[model samples]
Target chain A: MILFELIAPIVVMFALSFLHADRVRALLALSAFAIMLPAVQLLLQDKPFPLLGDYLIADRLNTYVLLLASVVGAGVALALMTLQRHVQVHPRAYFRFYRFFALFWVGLEMAILSNHMGLYWIGLEMATLSTVYMIKTNATRAAHKEAWNYMIVGAIAISLILFGIILIYAGAKPVLGEEAMYFTALLGAADRIPSPFLFEMGFAIVTVGMFVKMGFFPMNLWLANVERASFYPVAALFSGILESAIMVGFFRFSDVAKIVNFSHLAGFIFVYALLTMFVVAFLIYRAKDFMRLFSLSGIEHMALIALFWTSGGTFAALLHFGAHAFIKPALFLSTGVLESQGRYHIAGALRGYRGLKGKLFWFVVGLLMLAIVSLPPSPMFFSELYGFGSMIALAKSGHHLPAMIAAIVLLLFLLSIIFYRFVELYQSMKYEGEAVEKRVYGSELAALLLFAVGALALLLPFSLAFLRSIA
Target chain B: MSAFLTGAFLATLVAALFATRLYRLLMWYALNSLALGLLALLIGSGLNDPALIISGVLTLLLKAGVIPLVLKRLTQRFALTRQVTPDIKVHYAVVLIPAILVFTFYLAEPIGRMVGGNANSVAVAISSLFLALLLMMEHRNVAPKIIGFLMMENALFLLGTTATGGMPMLVELGIFFDLLIAIVVINLLFRREEAVE
Candidate 1:
């Protein structure tokens, strides 16, 4: 099943590459369903399934991430299908998009499933390469430049990650022998790894690398720019799926750090997350473009998720990840809908429209934004509540108390400002003009509804229990 | 022999930082890659490891031979400006390079103690990494940056071989595959950059 999950995307990519563009679109829906099936099966498995002598494993954490990537991959494909109906994209470009999109999914799934650190690095490198073109396809000078920067930064980050992995292997070699390459082997021998300092250094270096990859503060330069430059569907996948997979990879490393009793590691990530969230909140408030706004919003959500996980609120962290995974794409795709109508600013997104379509658009966009701000009853609301609750518990245990208090205060302050900004935008979205019935494509609406419903459904007892089970 | 090759590897990379001419930089990169390949081969034979031997041969053929040649063809085809101008001045680089090397030497000291390998070789691997990063940062040209990236990979490969005797064969193969894909992407990006300029 794991093999099929890994192979199906590549098969789809090759098949689409050979098909004509018109035919490719029809097959993409079926292709997405095919690619998602194995992932669904993996996600449903009660026991861990180790494959290929433990080089790949469908453990609970990774399987959940795999499901996220597969669902978002299919969602992005469906959204793009709707985009094709409204826009006049060249046939060759359309065909090329699906080809690379499939490749991106392959890389992401491979990275998530790999138990060997070296193979994990390789998978991420593949994903990074595919992402460069996804942005560059925008065909603007700024887009090209942003893609170029993304590649350079990504390449550098990946190299550093490799260096860190080698260092870890170096540290582990004396203790675990050849078994050191496998994550579980290293974890099993964590206390016996001979060189705790080297292990810690490697973890630090890997954290720095992931800070860049996951868009943490001080190394998040390329993220919003790249996301803003990409086509919205690609942006959706970038935020919704790719970032989640990378976080899962980092989490796997941190699990080792935890077992090895690197107490400072959690604090480092916590401070980093708090700083990222606070800074990105202001950036979101000041953002002029809707794409940039949501991109900054993604940084904030990822920071919050990191905070939750590192504070020992693993359940809240995973819950927040699911919430962001579902809602962020919906928000970005909502912007895509508005973008098609020449609305790129939050202020006037609904100014000219009227009647039921406008009302529905306003409601959907508003609900998603409300969820972004973690309004009551939203999944984000519960996640943030439990996340902060865990964080305060950690603080009372005397871990970086001053920094934690300041961060919590700063977070609440900045969050209110963000809430004010969203409310201001919601007010601006009120259209008092004459009714001009705007017909949105069914696929686009369906795509938005799909993710929005997914986000909302997380509030259900079943989803909550499932999330707790995974945690 | 590994010591001499490691020294040569670091030396060529340091020289590449000062190579003002594009072809000269590529030549320096080729030499650096050649030293890495030879070091891998030497280490592999000493350990009697077939995987490392194969990795060494591939590194030589691909990094030293094919990639540089492909890059040369790309530069000629694009008619990109051959004269290289780095944003950082040479004198500052001259002072800073040794500083970076010294810092990493200290950085690798504890790990070296733990591994009980030649501490100098670990120091050299890390210094080479810093020099490679400098090579990337000091250049404004796309070609140099790409070369720096490849050199970065070579330095990492050297570190793995030196530090761990070699990763699993599967990982080595995957790394090689990723490098090939990266070069293809680099080739395309170089073309696009040239076209844009």
Candidate 2:
């Protein structure tokens, strides 16, 4: 069962490529959804098994990530179906898109579930390569450039990671005595590591490499370019699912190394997270393109919340991850719809929607606005509350300053204002007469409803417990 | 054993310096790899490990013989006649290389004491890594970039063999696989660049 969950997606994706018919692609996606439902249930049971002599394994921490990937995978398939219906592209290229997206999804799953360092490295490389193709799927000049930047940076990061892995193995050889690079084994024998200084140096380099891949500030210039150039569904997966996997990597490393106390690292991460949120908030104010604005906002908020997780705010982090993953894609997909109708500007789209007097569009806009801004009863609100509570706990433990915690909360509140203020400006835009007829289909509407309701219900007890376990 | 390694190391140093002549870079790389392979062979013979001896011989053939030949062919195919001018002039590189070598020896002395291994091996590995970086920074062309990447890999291999007495065979295999994939990808990227031009 464990091996099946790990390898099934890769096999399914490879098989999907051989199927030429659109109907088959749709069926494959439905089958994927069916496979996912059982997999997530099994994962929630928290069983662990090693495959191929500890090279790969499944555990509780990755179970949540796999479930999230599955949901996003299914959602992307549905969105792709909508895209195929709307765009008059050739069937060959369209099917290729499906095939590549499936491969990308499966590769990420493998990356998250990998237990051995070398296997993890391979999985990450596979995921990066697959996503490169997705980024260049449309083959625009901008897409090509973005893909190039992503690939080069990704390869460099992987090389550094590999180097770090070698250093760790060298450092561990005296104690473990040969060829034992499994995470659990390493963690169990962590105290036997010979040179603490070398270990720290290697860990720092590895962290920086992973941080670059995670799109943290200063290393995140590639994020906007890639997100802007990718198709909407691809962008959605990049922001929602893939970033979560990178976060899982960070979490796993921290769990294994126990190098610095979470609070100490959280202090450094918190400062950058705040800077990212503020900078992105300012950019969002000036952003004209709707998709770009949402992408920037997603990057900002995700970094801040991820920092919160590092501060021992695990429950809050999981909640925010789930909420953002659900809401951001729906919003991006709507932006795609607007873009498809030739309304590139957010202000213009808002004005046009008003002219059409579309209640459904307004409802989606309202739900997303509420969700992104973390209004009451929204999953985001609860997540942020728990994050703040964790901050307070850290303060009481004397690991963090109370004043600093208060300031971060204040900063978040102000950032929220900036986000909604743009929505206000967008809503208030003067009408240019109905620019393009809205052609939203039933599938899109169903996807939006599913995301909205799903985001709301994810705050329930069972999910909260799962979040806490992994936190 | 120490005396033999010392002589081989001195020969390698001389060869590396003399290889600055435009026509002799491949010969220099071969000599460097030969010295490394011989060092590995001596270490293995001292440890009485036939597997390590086999690996050492394989390295000598692959790195010393095959790789340099391939690089020579690549240089010829590209008509890359322009001599590589070091970012630091050759005279300056000569001076800087010894300074780096001395510094690395100093840095690795304490580590060598702790690990109870040859300090010179660690120093050589560090110097090779620095030299590879220098190689990469000095050259702007694709061929040189490939050479730089290969040199980095060679340095890493040296670190694996000398510092830790050869990483797990699985790791060695993984590194080899990664390098193979990287080279293929680099070739494809260069092809795309040529097509664009």
Clashes of each: 0, 0
- Per-residue C-alpha lDDT of model 2 across residues A258-345, encoded as one tens digit per residue: 5423444555566767766666677767766766777777776677666667667888888888888888888877666666655354
lDDT of 2 at A327: 86
The DockQ of predicted model 1 stands at 0.72
Q: What is the lDDT of residue B104 in candidate 2?
A: 68
For residue A301, what is the lDDT in candidate 2?
Answer: 67
As a whole number from 0 to 100, the lDDT of residue A97 in candidate 2 is 68
- The pairs that clash in candidate 1 are none
Tens-digit lDDT track of model 1 for A264-315: 7776786677778777777778877778878877888888887788788888
Q: iRMS of each prediction in angstroms?
A: 1.2, 2.9
- Residue-level lDDT of model 2, residues B1-197, one tens digit each, is 64465446444543444343434756766776787778778878887866567767877888788777876775665566547544566777778877877886776666566556555666676566666656655654445545555666677667667767776656566566655555555454444444434
TM-score of chain B of 1: 0.95
